[model samples]
Target: MSSTTHNHTDASCIFCKIIAGSIPSMKLFETDKVYAFLDIGPIAPKHCLVIPKWHGAKITDIPDDYLMEIAPALKRIAIASGEENYNLLANAGTIAHQVVMHLHWHFIPKPDEKQGLGVGWPATKPEKKELQRIYDELKQKL
Candidate 1:
């Protein structure tokens, strides 16, 4: 871990305040690199927010190391939430409904469409050739 990742807190950020023990939150889990807690305004029953301890405004700004470190904690929270199925969502920007500027991942235990995390994907059934072409293009870029 870099020195930049150590105990840094933003006074203006709510998540920072929560991490710094300034604001009260229903903490679910905590580690040196990450924090997990219940969302104050939950869309579902087991709605939890997992965030990096570092004050990252968006996914692009957060270190990849911290991002990788949060996976195990997320899995644990999902399993403990007691829902067989769940959705892991991270909105990057304002257009994506990221109300809080901190880099947080939402773990919503989805029992049904009506209850927990409701998703409306504008999916299209593309031709096999089109799919292959798109995949090939992405693979080349990668």
Candidate 2:
């Protein structure tokens, strides 16, 4: 793991306030690197927001170790919520409906088909050759 330190917190960010104990939130779980809390305006029965303790406006800005640390928290939250299925979502920018500047992951437990985060993806079935080309391009970049 990287030994980099990130102690800066944005005073204006709502998530930062929540982590700092200035703002009140229904906290579900808290670790050294992450904080999980129920959403005030829940989309599902146990809709919650998991965020890194370090303040980062976007995913690219956050450290990889911090992002990786959230996985166990998500698993615990999902199991505690008593839902077998769930949706974990993170919107990066305004176009993606990210209202808060701080990076946070939404965990929406879906006990049934009708509830939780519903998505509509307009997808296309491309030819294998086209798929291979796209994969190759991405692989080269990686």
TM-score for all models, in order of appearance = 0.83, 0.88
lDDT tens readout by residue for model 2, 1-142: 1112445688888998888888999998787788999999988888999999888879988888788978898888888888888899999999999999999999998777788888899999999999999999999999
CA lDDT for candidate 2:
0.86
Error of 2 at 2 (Å): 17
Per-residue C-alpha lDDT of model 1 across residues 54-133, encoded as one tens digit per residue: 88778778878788877898899977888898889999889988888999999987787787777789999999999999
lDDT of each: 0.85, 0.86
Candidate topping TM-score = 2
- RMSD versus native structure for model 2: 3.1
Instruction: Give me the displacement of residue 13 in model 2, in angstroms.
Output: 0.4
TM-score of 1: 0.83
